[model samples]
Target: MSPQLLSLVTLWAAAALYAIAMVAWSIRLSRVADERIQARQGAGAASSTTAEAAAPAKERVAVGGGDDAAVAAMASGATSFVVDDGDETDLPRRSGADRALGAARAAMYSGLLLHLVGLIARGLDSGHVPWSNMYEYTITGSFVAVAVFGIVQARRDWTFLGAGVTGFATIALGIGLTVLYAESTGLRPALQSFWLVIHVAIAIISTGVFIVAAVATTLQLLQYERTDGERELTGGAIRRLGIRVRNGLARWTQRATWFEAIPSAQKLEAVAFRLNAVGFVLWTFTVMAGAVWAEHAWGRYWGWDPKEVWSFVIWVLYAAYLHARTTQGWLGRRSAWLSIAAFVALIMNFTVVNLFFQGLHTYA
Candidate 1:
């Protein structure tokens, strides 16, 4: 088979693997949720027993029948109640859940490897970079996202994000293969320069990181919404309906229990913040590099092109998000919303602007 055909086949295989990984990760998450629920129930039962035993001692102390030593002993015993550290290594293993997690991770790695092979084949066929068009860009972007996730997972157990990452990869690959497939072609004159390698490559990497950050922020927002409690709705019927729908979804998520397997809102926020910070730095360089390349190619540093405008808009949104998060103390749900808004703008810049809007950067 031709390199292009091989690349296509491998890409399809990668997508299939990612889909399998998503399912396995989801199963593992469900199992984890069940374990967390049971642990909470056990802790609750233990706490109730302790409270019952302490009631008489509390009454004796209140009646001045308990000596200082007795009160001290009760306090010491109360303090001795140890919180579970969540370490399950010593407990009997659930082989099915462990296998699911292991299988998910293995699939992720295998899919990523196949994705790399496909990209390499594409690059060989195109005789340049593999990301010169929308189809290639989509595939490459998803690959980078998964690569970033893998890199982070190596240092910490970020398996909670496995389902989201694989799900996104599968969807992106499906879109690339179906809607945006393109023949291997030589680069346009404007894209022939080395600047295309530097500018667009950095943009792709930053966008990938931003995708992961968006997922983290989305989780943070969901967890925060569930924990934030209910609020009265005061609006028109349509607006109230929307609010009611949102509240219903939050309530359903609260019942899912798998959400408990995810990190707390605070930790998710921190992870999102770090990811966004890295993405922002890379994106800042992307914009700067794009300007330098534009000056070299078009004899101008800045233009009011639709692509350039949207890129700048994305940069501004993320900049604002970071500034608000760091300086203005917009930490929890507010910061997550802002991060998500910036990500939405980034997606629009890539999809809507590229397809619908005309610009000098309309190579796709």
Candidate 2:
């Protein structure tokens, strides 16, 4: 096979591996949640029996200072309990969760290697930067997303994000291979400049960062709402669809304990804010570089092009998100919603603006 075909094969292989990783992570979360539910149920049952049968022996049990009194006290909500952290051999279920997490991490690492190899092969075959069109952009963007996730994982135990990051990469690769796939071809005249590499690369990187932040923001919003035990997922059809998508991984999202495993909503919001801050800075430079490139190619620094307009809209939305968050002291929910809106705008610029709107940035 040609290098291009081999690249395609590897890219698809990577996507499959990512999908497997996503499934594994989902199972990990699900198993953890299931075990927690069972434990809680068992504790509740034991406590109820203790509370019901404590009349005659209550004084004696309390005087004896035994496990029965402790159970009765905990059942009655009269005592505080601290869970013991013991050897892993004591909990077979926890050991299973660890194994699932290990498998997910291994699969993600393998997929990342294949993804990088595919991108390198595509670049070698095209004799230029591989991200000249939508197909190439999706592949490169997803690669960056996985790479960022890997780096974060290496530094910390970000296993909570494993399913989300890998799922995004898999979906993006599938879409690229289907709707956005194109033949390996040379760059168009307007893209025949070194600026294409610099400007677009930064933009792709920023977009990848934004994608990660978006996932965090989304989870934060969900967890924030779920903090109230009475809170339910309610909305119109589209909102229901989003909830359904999240609920598909029944293990990861079905239980409140799963959310508890991650950082608190405030901490998640802080992380998302930091990520968006970096993306915003890079995107600002992306706009400036685009203007410079436009001046060189189109003989003007500014035009009312559709892509430019939407790009500016994204910047403005994110800018407002930051301003409202920092200056106005917007709460977590509001800030997270603004972040989602900004990402939605970014998605529109890439999809709707490229396909429907007529503009100089029709290369997609």
Candidate 3:
């Protein structure tokens, strides 16, 4: 078979592995949730029994004098408790969950290796960089996203993110293969310079990082919403209906119990913030490199092209998100929503602007 065919086959295989990883991660999460729920129920029962046995001692203390002592006794006897959602070390590990998590890690590593192989084959077949067009860009971007996730997972058990990352990579590869597939062709005149390598490659990496950051931010938002009390719906019928639907979905997700295993909203927010910071730095370089490349190729530094405009918009959105988070103390749901919006703009810049809008950057 040709190198191109080999590349395509390997990419498909990688996507299949990613799908398996997603399923395995999901299974692990389900098992963890079940264990947590059972543990909580047992704790609740034990607490109730202890409180019942202590009721007469508490009454004796109350009647015997020392009002402050009575208050302390009552406080100690209170049954309400808060689970330490951020730490899983205290929880009993289940063999099934461990096996599922192990399977997920194995699948992710295998998929990443296959993905690397596919990219190498694509580069060989194209006789140049592998990300010169939409299809190649999607595949390369997804690979970078998964690679970054893997690197982070190595240092920390970020298996909670595995399902999201792998599921996204699989879907993205599917979309690239089906909707954006293109024949291997020589680069356009404008894309022949080394600047193409620097600018587009950085752009792809930054985009991938942004994708992972978006996923983290999204989870943070969900976790924050779950922990925070429900908002009151006050509006017309249609608006109220929408709110009801949203609240219903939130309630359903709350029942999953897996949220207890993942890190708290604060931790997830920190991870997202750090990822976005790195992505923003890379994206800053990408925009600058693009302008430099454009000056060399088109004899101008900044044209009001659709691509340039959208890229600048994305940069501004992320810049605002970071600035607000750091200086204005928009730390929780607010920052998460802003980060999510910025990612949405980035997606639009990649897909809508590339396909529908006409500009100098229309080479794709």
Candidate 4:
């Protein structure tokens, strides 16, 4: 078979694999959430039972009235929560899930291999590094997304994000193959510049980071929307969206246990906050580096180019998110919303700025 046909087949297969992984992950997360809720409720119920069982009898000791009060209080204290051995196992048995993680990592690696082949096939057809157009950008961006997720996953047990991230990578790959598919062609003078490396590398990394942050923030917001939506969660738009997702998840799971189980809003929020913080730092650097490249190429360090403006907007929005979360009382819901808002700006920066505004950074 021709290289082109081989690449197309590989791309489609990767998409299917990612979709499968996504579905499996969704089920796993839901199950884990159910488990968490059951565990907590069990603990609470046990504590309550212990308290009731330990209650002192109402029989009045012949001592002064104060003696009855003291006795009752002492009895309640005596039954206070005994630590059960099995309760400590609630941390989850990572060993049982090791094979799953191994499979996901294998899928990621296999997908990456095929992605390279597709990229190389396209490059062979184009006669260049394959970064000259939207099709190439999408493919490269997808590759970067998967690579970054894989690298990050290697260091920590963020496997919960596997379905979402892998699915995202697969979807991007599929979209690139289908919608953005094009005949590979050579670059002109305008495309042949060292600035391409500086600007586009920054853009690639920026896109990957923001996309990861978007996923994390999504998880955090969804978790919070279930438990205690913070004051900042008042915006009708987000609340409405959250309500829709909540309703769907409710229907999909059909059991109250699902809502009760997943990671706490606090934990998800921390993950999102940390990811966004790192993304924001990289974005800030991207903007700065792009500006420097802009000066070298166009003789202006700062111009109101659409891409430039949007980049700044994204940077500022995430900076504000980080700042708000830093406030004394803005730990959970409030901070999560800001993180969501930052991703919104990032989407706009990537899509709207590239398509609508015809400026120096219009390399969509």
Candidate 5:
């Protein structure tokens, strides 16, 4: 068979691996939901076994204590806590759902394997890096998203965000494979430069981060179901896990309190802000590099091409978001919405410019 077709087969294999990983993460999070809540409720610990309001903590969990007190304490409050670290296998097993999370971690690693093979196959077939088309972007962005999740998890306590982000990555890549797939080809004369590698690589990485931030931000909007008129932990760390949860539109503003058990609203906000900051910096570089390439190839840097205009619009939207957060009192949901808006602009530029605008940057 042809090498390109072989590459496509491998790509599908990678996507299947990713789907399994998502399921594993879901189970893992549900199993350890109580542990997550306990870890967050150190000094001001809450009992899933109580009938009180939500309590915020100044620090995380205390290590090597009597696990029974914590566990028994949470059975009534609707959100339970796991005090004992299960099976002393990994790091300070701070939560009850460690086993499931461990399984999720295994799935993430497996997905990474498939993603790498798929990307390598595409690159081998093309005889160059594979970030030159919509299909390539979808695939490459996915790999980067999972890779970034692993990297970020190693650095922080935000591994819960991985499942959603990688899930979206898989969906995007799958869409590309079925709806936007094409045979591999060489890079354009204009695209055959270091700038392509540098600019697009940054864009891919930033977009992956965008995927994570967007999911975490959206999760904030979720509401917990009540049992007997009291707020309860609906499904471990995920407040709304049931398939029938009402995610109606118009209420785009989400609260960080919903995730107070998973990651502090402050931490989630910081992660989102940091990701946006990095994406904005790279986007600035992307636009500037495009200008230089445009001047060399199309004879003018600021020619108001559709690609250029959309890129600038993205830059401006993000810039406005940053300004609003810093100058105005926009934090939490407002900032999250703006980040989503910026991504929408990015997708628009990537899509409309390539598909409809028909300009110098319309090679894809």
Candidate 6:
């Protein structure tokens, strides 16, 4: 078979593997949620029982002239009436969810490997940079998102993000295969420079990082919005609709316990900020490299091409976001919103600018 066909087959196989991994993570998340619910109920029952037993034990000690050890024994189910001061006990048995999570993680790694193989095949087939069009961009971008998630997972047990990252990759690859698929072809005259490798590769990497940060920020927003549960607010139709929308989102989020497995809103916001910071720095270099390449290719360093203009807008917005997060007291929802808006702009730059806007960077 030809290299392009082989790459296509491998890419689809990778997408399927990603879909399976997503399912495994989803099952693990559901089991974890159930365990949390049961633990909460058990804790409530134990606390109530302890409170009742402590009351009578205190009365008994006061009337019969015994020590506090008797009260502790009464509450602790120790029939020997002895006080155990140490907190150590038998280790708690492991749950099935741990094993399931392990399986899910293994699946993700396998899928990631397959995804890389496909990208390599594509590069071999194309005989140039694989990310020369929307289809290639989506494939490479999705791969980077998964790769970043895997790197983060290596440092921390963020298996909770597995479902989201895999699901996003599956969807992106599906779109690339179905909607954005283009036959392997030669590059345009403007794209023939070596900067194509440096500029577009950095841009794709930054976009992928932004995608991961966007996922974190979105979850953070959903968590923040549901912090206090549903509330009845008095307002006009538009205001009420907004409230309804939030409530609806809260209801949808409740369907999966995976969101509960993530870190707190504060931590998630910090994660998003840090990731966006790295993305912003890389994006800055992408713009700089693009300018240098434009000078080489078009004999001008600064032209207000649609792509250049949007890239600048994205850079400025993220710069403001980082500044607000560091200097001003902007964090949590504010920083998250800023990050989301900037990601939206990045998407628009990729889609709207490439397809609709007339510019020097209209290779797509």
Best by TM-score: 1
Once fitted onto the true fold, the runs of candidate 2 whose alpha carbons sit more than 4 angstroms away are 34-94, 229-257
Show the lowest summed lDDT stretch of 10 residues, model 2. Answer: 83-92
lDDT of 3 by residue, 61-96 (tens): 333334554455555664433333344445554588
**Cα RMSD (Å) per model?**
8.4, 7.3, 9.4, 10.4, 10.1, 6.6
For residues 280-328, write the lDDT of model 6, one tens digit per residue.
Answer: 9999999999899989998999899889999999999999999999999
- lDDT at 132, model 4: 74
Kindly list the per-residue Cα lDDT of model 2 for residues 292-321, writing each as its tens digit: 999999999999899989989999999999
Candidate 3 — worst ten consecutive residues by lDDT sum? 80-89
| Clashing residue pairs found in predicted model 4 | 33-261, 33-262, 37-261, 126-184
Q: What TM-score does each of the candidates earn? A: 0.86, 0.79, 0.85, 0.73, 0.73, 0.86
**Model 3 local distance difference test score:** 0.87
TM-score quality measure for candidate 2: 0.79
| Per-residue lDDT of candidate 4, residues 1-364 (tens digit) | 7766866777777676666666655555656665566678878887878866566655433333345444554555543222324335334446423545555666667777777787777677676776677778888877777777778878976667777788888778777888777775667566677767666777777678767767776766666544543233345897878666666654544344444434566776777777777777777778888788777778889988887887788788888888877865677767777777777887777667767889876655
Against the correct fold, how does model 5 do in TM-score?
0.73
Of the candidates numbered 4 and 5, which has the greater lDDT value?
Answer: 5
Tell me the tens digit of each residue's lDDT in model 5 across 11-64. Answer: 787777677777776665555554555566742554452434344333344557
> Which residue runs does candidate 4 get wrong by more than 4 Å?
1-3, 30-102, 229-261, 327-329
User: Against the true structure, candidate 2 has what lDDT?
Assistant: 0.84
- The TM-score obtained by model 4 is 0.73
In candidate 3, the residue pairs with backbone N, CA or C atoms under 3 Å apart (3 or more residues apart, or in different chains) clash, namely none
* Model 5 spans with C-alpha error above 4 angstroms: 1-6, 34-96, 223-261
In model 4, what lDDT does residue 95 have? 40
